[model samples]
Each structure stands twice: as C-alpha cells, then as structure tokens.
Target: MPDHQQRIAYLLARYVNKTCSREELEELFAMIGQENGPDIPGDLLEEIWHTAHPAPDIDYEQAYLHIKPVVPIRRSLPFRKIAVAASVLLLAGAGYWWLSAEKKTAQITTVQSAPAPPILPAGNKAVLTLADGSTVTLDSAGNQVISQGKVAIRQSNGQLLYAGQPTDGSIHYNKLTTPRGGQFRLVLPDGTKVWLNSASMLRYPTVFSGKERIVELDGQGYFEVAPDAQHPFKVKVHDIEVQVLGTTFDIMAYRDEQSVNTTLLTGSIRVNKGSVQQLLQPGQQAVANNQDQQLAVRAADLRKVTAWKNGMFVFNDMALPAILREVARWYDVDIVYNTSPATELYGGGIGRDLQLADVLALLEGNGLNHFRIEGRKVIVLP
Candidate 1:
C-alpha cells in the first residue's frame, strides 16, 4: 500500500495540475469532506475544488485567500545529499576543525526558505461614456443624470439604466467600458440584461424604439435580450451582425481572435455578414470571419461560453495567449512570458474570485511551468 502522506501528495499534485481523473477527483473530494484526513486546511480544499468545478455558488474571493501554497524548501544540494552532508559534518565536528570553522559550517547548513505573503482578492467595476463624451464610473454612488441628447442615463446597482419614458424616436448612444480588473452590468431600455467582461467595451443606443435595435461590441459580453417580436435585437461586431428576437447568447468578438464566435444559450439567432447569413439554435455557435466573409455553424458548450457571467474563468482547449489575456484583465496585471508556446491543451475551470497567487499556483502545478510576481506583473517561466 502506498504511504498515506505520499498518496495525498500525489493527489494534490494531480489536482493542482488539473490532471486528476474523475475517480481520483471523487476520492479527493471525499477526503476533503473528512475532518481527519491529512492536515489540509479547509480554505485550501475549497480553492482546489472551486478551481476544478466552478459554479455560481462558489465564493472565489474566499477560496483565493484560503489556499496557501507550500513553497519547496531550497538547499544548495538535493534533500538526500544535504541530509548525508549534515550527518558527516556532525561527525567531523566531534573533534577536528576549530570552533569558528565548525560554527561557520553549521550556520551555512541552517536552511531558511522564503515565506509567501497573504493573497488579495479583487472585484469588477468600469466606466461608461455617453454619446456627449461625458464619463460615468459605474462603481461609484450618487445618482447623477448625464445628458446624452434626450436620453436620461442613471447608474444604480452598478448598472447603467436608461430612463424609458422617452417622448420621441430620437437616437442617443452610450458606451460602457470595463477597465483592467473591472466589470459592469447594464439593463438597456429594451429590458436586455448585458454583462460586460473586463477590458471590454459596448456601444448601444439609449433607447431602442425603432424597428431594429442595434448595438456594437468589442472584447467579450453576454446578452439576455428581452422578447421584442416586432423589433429584433441586432449586435454588430466589426462586420458581422447577430439578429435575434428574444434569446440569451454570449459573443466573443475580441479583435485578436481569428474568428468571431457567437454562442446561443436560449431561443435562436441569425448571423449575417454582408452576403452570407447563418442561423443558430440553442447550444449552437456561429463562427464568422470578417476578413474572408465566411460563416460556419457548429455545436457549442453553453456553460463554457456564459461562464464569465457566472463569475468563472473556465477554459476548454484554450491557448496560453488567450488565457493570459483574460487573466490580465480580471487581475488587472500584466504578463511576461519566457517559455515556448504552451502546447498543452488546457481543459479545466476556475472561479473569477481567486487571488492572483491562487491562480499562479494552479498554473505551476502543470509540469515544465512556473510563475512569479514582480510588482503588479505576473511572469511565466519554463
């Protein structure tokens, strides 16, 4: 039988690396449920589970702070060699070298390791710029009305709401922007609930009174459009336009992506780009290329697409460059990498509430990778 401590260590390594099998994860979960299993802290256990299975109920901030990683003890030599050397030094010191030489050798062997600092968790907030060029920070309080032509813009509950009792068909535009380490939500006049991810921007009219409601987007956002049979909600990203009557969908239209992806969660939507048009159903996605004017429809995992709204950072076969883009936004930090393109296809989950260190630990669990922090920047080494 394997030693219990060795078994636990292996499981811990597998869990951190996101390489645990389902059965292994189940066993680890069972162990965590037990109060007498190892000396593992409750907070650290929660962080491990939350990273592997992120849900809306998980408190990312708590998990982020609770999971304290154990730094490896560093010596000038390997642990076995150090132990042998220490024994030899003890024998030699019995009666040979002078007291001062013996003292110096013992001092060199007195190993000291680095201690990690407490991790800090963060939340989301952003700014909204009205068509008139006035800015309103969403996280701040005090109801102030910003005039964007006839539209009355008000911020409440971190959401930018447009007063609906407008008197005309006049058009007014507003832009919602999420800065680094920030996010915001909005309820448009049409009753649509849109959640903007960090480092993203959205431009929409103050009122959607016309036959076609249109909006523009950059970065990422999740949209829950209210039913308006007469006036379809249309989202314009670069050149592609997503049209729907009433549906919940997530759109990834970041400028860096090779293809713009629109994933539908409920109801239906149509993607139209100049001469080409493609329709999508629930759990479906439309990948459109602005450069080539080509569109392809395929099945999509709805949870993975809308995970951001649920306060998670779930990735399925995502590239390292893409993953860092998201990590930089939520943590409000920059990344410096000194490694080959990550060839490993990552398939796992993590909550958005995790501290920067908590996330780096998970990434380092994977072999051939390590991370360090310098000021506000995260450096990835291999």
Candidate 2:
C-alpha cells in the first residue's frame, strides 16, 4: 500500500493499456530503486527486468519517451487490489455493454510479464485436408494433385491453392491446417489470398459458384478478397460475419483470442453480427466479441497488426501478454511466468528471425525483468 507500489500499479496498467512515455518510464524506474525496489516479488522481478531492457539495440530513453501515456486513472489503490479490481471492472464493463444500449470503452490492460519463449524453428510444413479426409502436404520437395469430386488442389510457390471449375447444384468444401510451430499461405479458387498464421485452420468451398462465398475460421488469417461486386465474400468468424465484396483486410479469429478483430486496409466492408452491421473504411478495425451484440470499430495501424506476415515483431506500446502471444505463435512455444513485472512499457523493434535469446537479451536491457528458456517453455522471473 506504499505510494511507490501504487505508482507501479498505475504505470503497469498504463503500459498494458499501451500508454506510457519514456521519461515517465525512467522516472518510474528511479522511483522503484529508491523505495519499493526490494519489495518487488522475486518472480515478478524477471518480468520487470525484461521490460526495462527490451532489446540490445534499443535506446531505452528514446523508445520510452516516444510512446504516449494512456488515459489517466485514479492511482491511489493498493497494488494487488488494483490488479484484481481493474480486471474485474474491465470484464464487467465488456459484459454489460453486450446487452445494453450503453457505449463500450476501448480500453484494456493485463497483469503479465515479458513474453519471450524458447526460440523454435518453423516446422516441416502444413497440409490441406480434403472433405474426403485426404491430406496434401505443401513444400518445394514435391507437388501433387488431389481431387474430391470436383476440386483441384495444387501446391506451388509455398502455398496451397484450391482452384476448381464451377458446377451448379452442388457444393464441396476443403480445409487447410497449419500445425504447431508452422504456417502456410493459400489462395482460394475465387482469387482470395489467405496468409494463415501458425496453428490456424480455414474451411472454404472448392468454388464460389454460390450467392455468397462463406468460410469458417479458427486461429488467425489475413485475407485479400478478390473483387466481385455482385457476389460478396463473407467470412464467418465464430458467430460474427465479416462481409466484403472486394477488399484487403486482416481477421484475427483465433478461438483462444478474447475478440475477433477485423482490420480493413483498403476499400469498404460491412461487419455483421445478427442485427448489428457496422461499415468499415480503410485504416479502421472492427472488434467483435462473444459478449458483445455488435462489432466495435476503431482506427488502427495496419503495420502493427500485419507485422507477422511482413516477417517482423513490432510492438508499438503493446502489453507483455500480447507480446508473448506473438512470440508463442512464431516460436511455437509455451510461456510460464513465476511473477508479475513492475509496471513498465516495452517500446522497440525486434525481427522475427532473431534468436529467442537475442530477443530476451533486448528485453533484459531495461534492467527490470529477467527470463530463462527451458525446452519449449519460458519461465519469467521478476
């Protein structure tokens, strides 16, 4: 309940919410060392150390100052109480907004540390599972053709394509799955470009010969839908449906994700969930959750959302947990935290190709958090 602990909690919430400047971070660090520095739990110390350091190439002072401060909140509560209370309030607010006419707030925070897992190499490859249960693994080694009545499967250019001649009266579906630590790309018969992130699956028909081209998804995928004014491309993500005629967008519809985010890069599209239909323009993102009746639209930075496809890990004021999620996907590893970190922000750059240690080394540069990699698990210490 000391003022130092309260300030740390306040800053922790701010960092997780993607708002905290470098000068503020430096001030916080100095304050931590002065008063409650030793009071910080041992397990959380590693996370704190990681956040302070971020990466070896970073100018901590500059990176910290470049980021913005989040909306100010009352910071007088005890650290533990604030953590529990904030999470509870956030959950309740999201739930309450789902069934009422009240407007929902676009704020989020988490109590977690730096997310660097054991570096993992990309796995063999991914496979396309036909409706008849036949599988086709894609790579440069070999390419084969598989037919399930009418669809043709081709593996070329490191991608699996489902190109088929259309037939009236009947429809056939095919599935693409990427295993743990693996990822793949695919082009639907209708020219829809899909980049499936690791551990993702997409189910679509062989042909878009119907009134609407609909697909089901699990995990994350970025799509560039081919233009067809008359026939719209509808993506069924859980209960939400993203309808687009021709546009470039990204959809993070992973089941484990708290919300399905549909970020539009170009053109126009409509996101619908039952009675709720929200129109989106370029540079806009629509977030739909199971608890909400409608999709929430907001401005977004396309680069940050699609950084994985571009072969980088860009954290523009991201929380420790969210950052870890990206690391887990790319490295194909699990994360275990022994403690929560002192509220600090991580602002810098790291490539996806870097070794896991290199990434952690950067985080440790902050001198607040520490990390250890054990097999496929990353144990974070404060």
Candidate 3:
C-alpha cells in the first residue's frame, strides 16, 4: 500500500494526465478533504515552476501569470505549488488547481455553463482627475501627454508617468481612480511607482517639495517608493499612516473589508494609528482592525498581498464571502448567495486575465461551493 504522500502524488499526477477514474477522483478529493492536507516541499515547488511547460492552447505569457504564485498561502496545503501545476495544466482550459475537467481538461464546475455572454476581465482602465477637476479617460487616451497647469502628465502603455516638476509651492492635488473591473499604474513626480488595484483611488500632489512626500489612498495599492531619506514618504489610509524612507509595500483598505492591511516587502516602515505606532521590517505586515480600533504586526504573505499586481487572483484560506468581494471588484459583478457557504478556508488562484466563467469554474471544482451567473449578478450555490 502506498503511503499517504505517495498516494496524493500519484493521484495528482493522474489527475493532471486525465487518467483518473471516477473512484480515484473521489479518493483524491477525499484525501484533500481531511483535517490537514499534504505537506509538499518548497524546493519541489521551485522545480515544478522551472521545468513545467504550459499546454498548447495557452500562450507563454498567460501561463506565466498562473505559474507565478511565489509566496506560500496561510493554509495547510502549500497550494502555492499546486497553483503552479494548475496554471500549466488545468487553468489553460480547465480548473484553478483542482478539478475534473468538463472535457479533455476534465470538466469540473457545477455552475451552469449554458450559452451566455461571458464577463471579461479587467484591463488598463482608470480615470485621472486633474487638479483643475478635469478628468481624462486613461484607457482610451493611449500614449499621450496632458498638461495640468505647469506639469506634464504622460499616459502610455496603461501607465501614468511624469518627471519630477519644480513646485511653485502652489501645491495642487490630482486624483487617480480605477473603476470597478479596472486597474492602472502610475509614476509619481518623485519616481515612486504605484500600482492601483480595482476600484481604488490615490491622491497626490503635482510635485514633491517641503519636508515630506505624502499620498492618500482609498482602496488598495502597491507602492515602490523612491528613495529619499531626507524627505520621508507617507501613505494616508483612513486613520492609519504608513511612513517610510524608501521601500516596496502593499496596502489593502477596501471599504467592505474588515481590516486595513499594510504589507512591507523591502526596507523598514512605521505604521501609526493615532497614538499607537508599530515599526515593521521586511516581510512584515501591519493590520489595522476597524471594528476594535487596534493595530498589530506579523509576518507578511508577499505573494498573496501583491498577487493583484502580478496578474493572479491568489487566495489562501479565505472564505467565500471575502473571495467574492475580490471577484466583485475585478469583474464588476454582484454576488447573491442563495446558500450560506461552509466556513472552510479554501486556497487557489488563476490568471486574472481569464473571464468570470473561467474563474468560477476554478473555484467550484475545489469541492466547497458552486455558482450561478445572472447577467452581472453571481448567484452562489451550495
């Protein structure tokens, strides 16, 4: 008899190869359903990433997006590795990480896939509101430079960039907003790079000057702050402030989310909430709980935190409700739950470039829940 690990490995290989019998598929899912899932090694994951090739249908760039879940999720399964396998083999035409493809890829979802219009994924779309209150539709602007007062803002290749302008001390504010099902990138006057996620907003000055550089954030963004030790950079999110000299970090502060999370990738930062302050090192995260009005620090999940910027929807041990919120933002859909979901922390991810039906298929094959789509509304089923 094979050991548990050996059996899992065998079943997974067979599943990928589309050679699994119904019984074997049931057994495989049952094993994963146990209290604790398999423990795969990190090196093996790296090996899979380095050697695996995508199926013929998927292009190299598309497969690369799915294969790049670098950080481990906070779950029993090091599903980050499985995500690699899923991307190369399954998500090319089938499921997320685990599923019985409906066809050669092993059809898996319980969601009704009758002929219907598909909801496409988000792209480089944002509305830039200049200091003069004039708005430029960035997605259609292509590569163009628009002048706002004395500053010249450049929009190209889905990015908004501008060279550092000398401030006349007039201090005008410009806002960048990513609508639902849209995202955008920006290069601030000081060379700081900002990746705005879906339904997020960032407000900044026309140029860097005075004692410090500051920006206000309303939803989510990943920041690679330009190094300026003399002039610290600070991000204002509600009541919390993340202050740093030069560092790469991500912040999630959606109005619907329960907590405001700040994950630091490189360099050090100080997170201040009123009088309470916490210093964070690289690979650390500061979480501000809205309900209790408290702040705490812990090790960060870099992959999960910055997955949006990387072009994957990686979720680890997240509940259905929370995951749907992400889906709603990126796909611009409403979630209507006909059945309350089990409180299990499911983990998996797919390339964000895929459509809504593809994403739901990936999630449904996990054996936790399924979905039904009505127009722009996603009806969650048990």
Candidate 4:
C-alpha cells in the first residue's frame, strides 16, 4: 500500500477505536474531501466489522450510501463489506464523524468556486456571567477552573462542571449563555446535567437553596435532574414552569418559535402555565402555543427531539422553514426569504459537524428551494 493509504488506514483504525483527536479528525476529513482519497482495503474493513462495536442509532448501510456518491467507493466490490465496515468503525464521537442515517441518504455538494469562506459548525463555546455580573468566555480550547467563593467551577472536555460546596448560604446566580454558532454542556452544583443549544442562556443558583432547585432557561436545553426527592427540581421559561422531583427532559422555549415544547424522556414532569397544569409522562411531549399559551400533549419523536444533543440534525418530516431555522442557529447565519416559505416536509439527518454550505447543499438537493449565501445571511430562492 502507498504511504498515504497506510496513514489513512491508521487514522481510520484510530477513529474506530475512539482515540482520534480533533486535529486528527480534521486531517482525516480533509483527506475525505480530497479528489483522490484512497480506499480502505476490503479485508481491513472486514476485520473492523468483526472486532469493533457500532454506536447506537446508526444505520451504517444508509450512512455508507450517503458517502459513497462523493467519496471513493468501488461498485466492483461487494456492498456488504463496505457498508458493514463503515457501520462498525465510523464511530462519530470523534471529529472525523460524518453523516449517518436511519435509512436516510446524503449527497456531497460539489463546489465550483469560493464565493466566501465556509461557515463552520458550532462547538463548546459560551459566556459565563458571574454573580457580580462579571463575564468569562468558555470554549473547547479552554480548560481551567474559576473560583467563585467556595464553589469550584471547572471547564473541561467542553463542559462546565461545578464542584465543592458553597461556603456562604446566600444564593448567587450565575448565567451561562451560548451565542449563535456555539453550544455548551454544564453540570450544576446539584449534579444536574444541562446541554444548552446554540443561541441559548441558562441561569441558575450556585447552590440548590431552600426546598427547590430552580433554574431559568431562555432557549433550548436538555436536562437530567440529579435525582433529588428531597428538593424538587424546577425549570422556568417565560410563562411556563416545569416541576419535577427528578426527571430527564428537554425544553425548547425559543421566543421566535411558534410553540414551546417540553418533552419528557425518563421521569414525569408537570408543565405549569398559570393555574393550568399538564402532566407529561415518559415518551410524551407538551406543546405550549406562544400566542394563546395553551398546553397540548402529543407523542414525542425521541430521536428528532434530542438530535441536537447527540450531534445530529435528525428532521422527521419537518417543514422547510422550521429546519432552516435550526440550521441558521447552528451555523450562526441569518435566513432571509426571498420568496414565501415552502411547505415541503423533509426527513433524515446529517452530522452537526458538517459545514454550512454542506448542510445547505444537502437541503437544496431535496429540491425544496435554492439557497444563496451572502456574508452571514442565507437568502432563500423559490
């Protein structure tokens, strides 16, 4: 084998074993985008399938098909080998993670020339507002601990973890805000885990005070309560409040969105809007209309509901405008409609790690609408 091919194989193996670093992932993907990226040996792929276990919710065959059109895949060889190999070794936990689908497909967009620089995907980035209103920038490149009183706030591995007990019993509120083109993970002092999406803010006390552990979220966030039966965990957003003893759920209360949705995953939660309260069971979602603030219940699409937290954009028959709204948030771009919003519904998903152009191209390939990029704005054409 050639030197480049050997290197590719090594990187591919490292990727499958889940040891590839961010720089290595960038290199591997650069090779994938190359004109003559080398193919992996079929035998090596077979070995990979036999040894490595695949990640959950991955349809390797579908993902392989998505990549085969653009990447080098020889039809002369058996399809099963390539598909199985991709299924087993192409774990997306690393940066080399590409598009995988559950019976979905992807077509790599062809670029003719550069109109502007690529808009990259969001990473672990946010702003931490201290109790005194002081601010600190936190990103994936940062790994440090910020001391505020007795609580030790550690930023590591793209997540903010709070350690130690608060010395003073007085409540101190700290806010973590992720601007456009950013996302963040946080562990509260009470051990509750929060994954904040792009263009979102989470405000909470440094310590769980009194009888309730309450936090305020301004956008979308996934929460896994610390299982405290003694102190009930509460989430307040706008006019709605979610009350729970201990539960796993997601709340999307973006003001721009038509409705505020609270999806329950593991435990039960009560969605309170004034005197009206709706209880949500596991696998159920409560939708509160923005205009009337009326709460409605429906079965939740678990995968699509939590796709962002899992590093994917799994849309399940979502309308074109709704999908574009999400894309805009992740890529930190403004969507200007040159024409009326299309009523088309789309399915399937792609990796959140892909670029904005790539994502737009994938969506355009569905023949929904033509998209043009102008600086930070994405203009839609009919």
Q: After superposition, which runs of candidate 3 have C-alpha atoms over 4 Å from their true positions?
A: 1-14, 21-23, 36-114, 164-168
TM-score of each: 0.69, 0.68, 0.82, 0.73
Residue lDDT tens for model 2, 1-382: 6676667666644443335554555554454433224354433433433454342332323332222211112234233422222231222233112211111111001112344333645543687777778877765455677666666777766777776674554777788888767778888988999998888889998877758889988888899999998899998888888889899999887766678899999998899887888999999999887676757889996767887677666665456667677777777778788889635544334556665554555455454666666667767778
Candidate 4 residue-wise lDDT, 93-181, digit = tens: 33123322211223223232345577899988999999999999999989999999998999997899987777767889999999989
Q: Any idea what lDDT model 1 has?
A: 0.65
Task: Give the Cα error of residue 353 in candidate 2, in Å.
Answer: 1.6
Candidate 1 C-alpha lDDT tens digits along 1-382: 2366456556655654545554674464344333334444434434544554453333333322222221111222232322221221122222112222332333234311233453454455788886668877767454566666556777776777777554666677788998877788888988899988878899988887668999999988899999989999999888888999999999998776688999998999999988889888898999987579789999996766877787776665566677777788778788888776556544445557766665665554343466667667777777
Pick out the ten consecutive residues of candidate 2 with the lowest summed lDDT. 99-108
Q: Which stretches of candidate 2 lie over 4 Å from their true place?
A: 1-118, 121-124, 140-142, 166-169
lDDT digits (tens) for residues 100-192 of candidate 3: 235213222335455567799998899999887889998845999898766899999999987646456588889999999999999999999
**Lowest summed-lDDT stretch of 10 residues in model 3?**
100-109
C-alpha RMSD of each candidate structure in angstroms: 13.7, 13.8, 5.4, 11.0
- Top of the candidates by TM-score: 3
**Per-model C-alpha lDDT, please?**
0.65, 0.64, 0.76, 0.76
